[model samples]
Target: MQTLDLAVLRTLIAVVESGSFAAAARRIGRSESAVSLQLKRLEEQIGEAVFVRNGKQMTLTGAGARLVGYARRLLDLNDEALAVSEKSIDGTVTLGVPHDVAETWLPAVICGFRRSHPSATLKVIEGRSAILQSRLADGQIDLAVVLTATRPANALWSANLPMVWIGRSDFHLKKNEPLQLAAFDPPCFFRAAAIASLEGADIGWSIGHASNTLPDLWSAVSLGLGVAVRTPAAVPPGLTVLDGRRGLPDLPPLHVSLCGPPVEFKKPAVDCLRVILEECLAVSIHAAA
Candidate 1:
């Protein structure tokens, strides 16, 4: 086996980014022939061609595309290694969180973390709670905030927060008009709960709109399209809570949990992030209460 050269990797990345050998050579401060030779040697070592020739253009072959992805990540890792050698606590923490939570809660949480540990970078991936949970289970992120019907596996903290029913302030209905809802598609706890509650109450209700994403659904609700079920902390601005004339049960509170990959949680950086997230969660829960 032979050693892989960082110079070759750098050249490959530059070529990919620049989209041509000449441009790559110019960007990396190397002659075009030198760049081409480095790529040929890299391909020989890897036993595959790294790029497809198209006149003056260059594109990665399937194997080449995959290798470029790995090469880019390796370069990023090398950069981080160098950065961490000089700076304290330098690394990336990928966090998975729900969309609504990110919109309402993440800025404050990130601001606090950055203030305390400026060298540690944060990357946030926002999606539905279920998707975030899957990513956490796969060790794709350092930590996550998720909602589950029951206790989440291997979690450090859990709290129940009330989900509220809200409608636009300008919305009007006949005396007997039942609540109509704008909801996300299936696998959404809020949507399921809203439907279950309305059906159980025998209200004359219907699905006014459905969105594959939360922001769009919230937009629809804010436009007086229909009522929406949301966590109290995330009630859209300018919306009013709706109530049944007869006493009705508050929507079941969602169980928010703090979780991470089991191994990563042992690191100090991960632990610091855990504490920060828990503190933020506590403040949010209290504020909503």
Candidate 2:
């Protein structure tokens, strides 16, 4: 049997992720025909079909599923090997982040990181906390900046964050009334906390509006759509805390931290990247305060 080629393996992984040969081609900056040819050659080496295609949609066969895991490990190892020899603070760190956090502090963090490690590249994916968590589990991201963290696990980085509710000073609170809330959809940790607090307080409340997008929700809050529960760092311009009002029991502090393969912890590139992330968090706290 012929030896497996890493390039071809990487190509296959891309195709599986991208969902089509054409998409994979675009991602890798190769022609579709070239990607198809690579897949053909890869299958020949494996002695079985690696993909099942029906029209444009493709699914990984059992063999392809097995190979997918191996391919990611191989690529990670490939990166580590390259990093070892270079011994330079230069490489890419894919980060999954929350949208509001990205809007507020990511730029400063990126700028600071670049000044210190110009060659270190950043690829950011912005989404809600739950989505970011899924990406972290899948190895799609090297590190994540999230609201909460778990115990020191084999494949996790954890930290506790003190979060707060923010609103415009003009936002009025009726004494003994339910708090009006502007929030995102379900599974949003902050939103869940806000709702639970109001209900627990037996305060009469109403939803001003809801959104799946952070910008829309922010706009709602800015226009006094309603008050929102957010991290201190995320209170937008022209907003202030509604201090006299209290809802629910004390909200659990948000935990923000990073998680990735334990092997990455040993890599200098990963360590440098983590420092950049921690720096970002520090700036966030200071700016919010």
Candidate 3:
């Protein structure tokens, strides 16, 4: 029996994610026919069909579902296997990240970096998007991951962060009552968004608490200080997403972005880090959404 091709497995993963052979082709930089041929070849190699079409949706067959899990594992091993030979990468690379992501989404990036560049040093600076973006532009960091309400032109990669209203379970908003809020410190997108959304809806609001970090914010929120906008996926365990029946204006999906130079100084190493972080964030945000 022939060995499973890594390219085919990656393509298959993309197809499952993209929901169609054509979209997956676009994602993996292959022609639709090429993707289809690869899938056929994969099925031939495995001696079982992977995907079966059901009405408008192409659902994965039992065999396909099982292989999907294996594909992810193999892909990671492939990345590590390749990174092991990378020579003499010993520079200190500064990575600026939002505080929220530093807690929830950064461990994967850090683990991948440590595995791939054992000799390299990574300095992390945590702040809000405005501060991170400014630092990136000023060359204070090699790259910065930030959250934005809209996708910008230079975003290396962008993913959806689902925004939700979060508050205590029994919290209720009386008619035209000022929206009590526990806001993140200045330079926070969530705070600005919540205020803008409330004001646009002609809703009065007051800042009941201000927090500089996730723990403080979570604490303030859990204490029923006020309602806040947060990405439910990254929200702390105690807070619950407010019911949509509350007549609150819908918050738009936050665009999580990675920003780096047009040409990184450490091109090869930086490229490796970028791909790892991008894929990690993609899977994370996709799951959250």
Best by TM-score: 3
lDDT of each: 0.74, 0.69, 0.79
Off by over 4 Å in 3: 1-80, 264-266
The lowest-lDDT stretch of 10 consecutive residues in candidate 2 is: 148-157
lDDT of 1 by residue, 145-228 (tens): 887777787678889887878777666555577666788877898888877876776766778888877778888888777788
* Tens digit per residue, CA lDDT, model 3, 108-193: 57866777787777788998888888888888888889889888666888887778899888887888578889988787799988
Better of 1 and 3 by TM-score: 3
Clashing pairs in 3: none
Point out the worst 10-residue segment of candidate 3 by lDDT: 25-34
TM-score versus the correct structure, for each prediction: 0.65, 0.61, 0.72
Clashes of 1: 0
How many backbone clashes can be found in candidate 2? 5
lDDT of 2 by residue, 41-149 (tens): 7788888788888887788899989989999998778656655545377788787778776766576456545555656787889987678778877878777777753
Maximum-lDDT candidate: 3
Q: By lDDT, highest first, what's the ranking?
A: 3, 1, 2
